[model samples]
Target: MDLTEQPTFAFDVFSKACPSRGTLEHVTGRWGALTLGALYEGSFRFNELRRRVDGVSEKMLSQTLHALERDGLVHREAQPTNPPRVDYELTPLGREVAERLLSLIHFVQGHMDGILEARERYDTARGGR
Candidate 1:
């Protein structure tokens, strides 16, 4: 099909029905953010990932990995061990996204103190929740 023949759709994240919005949510959700950030170090097995991500349940990790795998960001490989060793790694696309996430994380880290202070001031002004 020629370029002209290809149909195009508008992508507006503000729209309630945008697919990219859902993808954005999935990638930046607490579990997705932590999982991808941890994988930036290297591939890890299921338990290893669980330990690295901190506070992620087995079900959440499994679901996150599967979602990322579906999005072509994460790679899942299984070794033929007696118990079957499954390793998870970031694809090049995933690395690109992970790098962006790392930048966001660093920004949050640098701003956390101020953020907490703001929260405190806001809470105090509101008579403490």
Candidate 2:
């Protein structure tokens, strides 16, 4: 290894202590996923994002944005104004992650009928428990 060369780390999400696990959680959690998907459409102000991500409370959205921002997946911009304005958008890395997540989202949505059917079958077999 060259003295001045940076060391590279192999991050494995399956490892309990791996930092990537935390980031993966942040990217895939309910609020995190919704927040990222909404931002993927475009930049949005706080309230706008709250509305777009429907069901996410103001507190959850705020926390999700903070986590994503810390993970380098979200960019937060604040402007000085009469009432103060802030916008959230995906960083380049975030866009890439969102693209992959959207693929999975679409797949799940497309298969929802089958998924529901499977659930119905499972419930029926279990006597609706």
Candidate 3:
């Protein structure tokens, strides 16, 4: 009966349930990372996002935008004009995540040689050299 001795869970503010696994999947998603990176440059419309992230299908880009918006990491604006212009930007929270992701990209680019060497070693070990 020593409830005070138990540790509190930050994720279980409402109850004992932890954060949903979908959260992780959303953040680490293939297009999600790239979307954040693209948005970091500035606000862009849907087509612009699609253009910046080459090879991303329209459906996938839409899904990624929805997920980011749901997570409060992205801001979506729609104008009721003749053509109806919509733009997407990063929220402050998103900027934090984007900066971290940018740093990761820089790190990977800087260490690409080491990564290539490691891949070569693995390929040789697998007799695929």
The local distance difference test score of each candidate is: 0.92, 0.93, 0.88
Task: Please list the residue runs of candidate 3 whose C-alpha ends up more than 4 Å from where it truly belongs after superposition.
Answer: 1-9, 12-17
Give the C-alpha lDDT of model 1: 0.92
Query: lDDT by residue for model 2 over 4-51, one digit each (tens)?
Result: 885666876767999999999999999998889889999999999999
**Candidate 1 stretches greater than 4 Å from native:** 1-10
Shift of residue 66 alpha carbon in model 2, Å = 0.2
lDDT per residue (tens digit) for residues 10-96 in model 3: 564345455645655676688988899999999999999999999999999999999999988999999999899999999999999
- How well does model 3 score by local distance difference test? 0.88
Candidate 1 per-residue lDDT over residues 2-88, each given as its tens digit: 876745658877689888787778789999988889999999999999999999999999999999998888999999999899999
RMSD of each predicted structure = 5.9, 6.3, 5.9
Q: In model 1, how large is the Cα lDDT of residue 112?
A: 99
Local lDDT at 21 for model 2: 94
